[model samples]
Target: MPQLQAAVKELQEKGIALPDYPDEPGTDAERDARARYDKVKGSAVNPVLREGNSDRRAPASVKNYARNHPQLMGAWTPESKTTVATMGAHDFRSRQKSVVLPADDVLTIKHVAADGTGTVLKDGLKVLQGEVVDGTFMSAAALEAFLAEQVARAKAEDVLFSVHLKATMMKVSDPIIFGHVVRAFFADVYTAYGEQLLAAGLDGTNGIAAVLAGLDGLEDGAAIKAAFDQALADGPRLAMVNSDKGITNLHVPSDVIVDASMPAMIRTSGHIVGTRR
Candidate 1:
């Protein structure tokens, strides 16, 4: 009685139209609609509880149906909860290892020859000649030291130079070692160049001025050498040329050539040296 009452109450609330019992035989469409409405209302009165024992009834019914119809259970078994848990744990551990593994950082240097000579000189020469050096460094300290050395040398030589340093952090497994190697390489190059420059008499004011003038359009080595010699009688005159590509090429005039070439002169003398670490 309660179920019937609830269904009747639900039908009234939903505003479903119901036919009188004395009506003439209903058409097929009318009968179908009435059947659907009755079925829904009937279920609503005693709604199945999916979260309780009532929920288990559906699967049990399905199992019984499969038993009665064995073909439906062919090659089918309920999945084991333990196997699923083990697989989930394995997947979790794999993801953890992936998270713990370190990443790789790559640093590269790109140099373009100013003279289109397919050769790019190192930092010191490039700065003195006012050329471009584009590259990435793994070690910030190494890059900083290299730039500072170049700037200092240019200032000492009375040559105009400028620099811009950009820093960024990248993930790497061994960033410290990578940085140390980079620093060591540049330091060696700087030391080598410094030794070369000291040997040349061109380390002083007069030498730098002569070099600058030579770079400004004075191509005749003898003329520039004479001018430098006259300006600084104390030290011998040295003619230096910095190619548009930033390579410092030094030439000792025949007149100034002693038994041996000056150290500074030899350093800047040939093609720029390009070496990698």
Candidate 2:
């Protein structure tokens, strides 16, 4: 994390003024003189409370000031505890109205690799084994194209490809439009991949459905394992769960020989996208 002092210093170096300090003494008379001067000047002389203040004041300071000087900061404003409480209640109600469930009838896929060691092939192939037998190298586009075809085939076989949205730096919202945007974006991706799969004669029985349920009911580990199990049972496993940018692989028993190619499909099929938040 960047240090607050460094940020402040940078701002100062950039000629940005710090927030005015209304609490700082301006005159010996203090309250009376300050109030009189404010009335006469029609502005606060204190740098912290002055009009057109441009200082990047921290929230903590504002909160502290409100806490210590409720009489000064209007009680009806958001800074007041009573107002904040009211806003909180109102926000809760608003969220209840705006809350959206996950997409509809979606089944998630969890990919487990050899010892959970999986690599993400964004636009390239990761050769986990022998060198290019013919010294042939596959480009990122080629690899992505290959994986996209496989995902499409899976989708055709009533299996939906997990569509993911890269929402790093996305702001949280009670009524989120980004969800719709994500759905639309991934729909396009699946469509394109589906077309490629068809061209490659790999399109199979796959079904795409919206994710409608929450994972709150299951334990953490159970939920993770359940995703993998469902992928095995379901023909076209689709998971939209968030993943770190890196790839992971899990080694399971030899008897649990899932498809060797399935992990690659899951990693590239939009299941591994992440966000900053």
Candidate 3:
């Protein structure tokens, strides 16, 4: 835990209020610490940089297409018996853009392998002084509040809750956030077994199915699974990615992105697929 403390110190020194890194944290302090770490892990970056000037409008292409293809867009009617609910980290849209300047630039991406090898991912292009680049969140408290509000709202409204994240584009980031939502939704299970799960190479950022699958050889796997099942029963209704397979939207990060899922929900008159039952 000293290492975690040191890491936390390092981040804090750099202005990041990172939670105490939880490596099999057990006590309430540890569990709370873990929760802190999880909440802060993914999807918590956009708000800070937004500073109210970030670009968040729908793209021109989407608007123009919507205008030309009204039929493709859905009209909200009072008689429509559909409810499409969507939520994601606020930073999901709080994205900033940096342009490549023409004058001076020296930025490069490197790929490091486990064997201590390095490969260049991108060579920094020369850029002018005014050129921009973007930085990307919740790896703690900020994200936990956002997700909790979403769950509480959905519960009060009695509507299916679905999270829409840019898992594909974000690749590592979004999925990690998705995992946090999973952990938040099933707090008890993770609190009790996060240590074990982490041992199994599972973290809160993978699909629930992955966690379930990762439980394969662990001793308390069956008991933990039961907890997950009970969680589904006790929590707010979740939107399904495949109700037939008992797969929920929180199963994978990129499974349900906003752009794709939002329009699809509209097309279906505001309800997610596989929730008719």
Question: Which candidate should be chosen as best, given lDDT against the real structure?
Answer: 3
How close is each model in CA RMSD to the real structure? 36.5, 26.6, 16.2
- 10-95: candidate 3 lDDT, tens digit per residue: 78899986455678987888899878656645544454333355567889999999788786555678976455433345453454
* Residue 45 error, candidate 1, Å: 94
Worst 10 residues of 2 by lDDT: 247-256
Order of all candidates by TM-score, from best down to worst? Answer: 3, 2, 1
128-149: candidate 1 lDDT, tens digit per residue: 1222233332334443455455
- Candidate 1 clashing pairs, residues 3+ apart or interchain: 199-264, 200-264
Error of 1 at 152 (Å): 15
Q: Say which candidate scores most in TM-score.
A: 3
In candidate 1, residue 6 scores what lDDT?
50
Query: Least lDDT summed over 10 consecutive residues: which range in candidate 1?
Result: 162-171
TM-score of model 2 vs. true structure: 0.19
Give the whole-model CA lDDT for all candidates, comma-separated: 0.34, 0.34, 0.72
